[model samples]
Target: MVNLNAVLLISFLLFSIGVIGVLIRRNALVILMCVELMLNAANLNFIAFARHSGSVSGQAFALLLMGFAAAEVAVGLALVVALYRKRDTVQVDDINLLKG
Candidate 1:
């Protein structure tokens, strides 16, 4: 019995927080976590709209997005580990592997 407007508002707030976190945080891990937060907010929006419109496509897309986010996290973490091993730091400004 939750209202669609309320769900949308919550999702928007979550997404905004994630964006701000990503923008303000300097650690790579924190940035990745913020990205996950944003993805979850999008999934919430998908589920809410799916329920509101009486369709399963949005839910399906949300599920797929979850899988994609999982893979992205895995890859991103691996890269961070590698960078930390090579550079001894995970700060966004301290490591520059793409300076070419």
Candidate 2:
């Protein structure tokens, strides 16, 4: 059986890495991917806790969160594609809110 502490540690590490990537990356696509990673990490934590507690609620919530993440990715990618077509670039720094 995997230790609960170990699972939590790994999830925390994944979350931290995702946060760093989102903060450091300038490309919109990279940022979006990092956000997804963070969401996955949270899902992992939910699953781990649910497994340890022998409850279905956390897993159910994780599934719902995944669905939301999927929708968010779809919309985010569409926006990125539209922005790329209009701006010819995906760099976050280059895109100005007022210009778009």
lDDT tens per residue, model 2, 1-100: 7999999999999999999999999999999999999999999999999999999999999999999999999999999999999999999989888787
Model 2 alpha-carbon miss at residue 70, Å: 0.5
For every model shown, the clashing-pair count is: 0, 0
Clashing pairs in 1: none
lDDT of 1 by residue, 1-100 (tens): 7999899999999999999999999999999999999999999999999998999999999999999999999999999999999899999988666895
The TM-score that candidate 1 achieves is: 0.93
lDDT of the candidates, in the order given: 0.95, 0.95
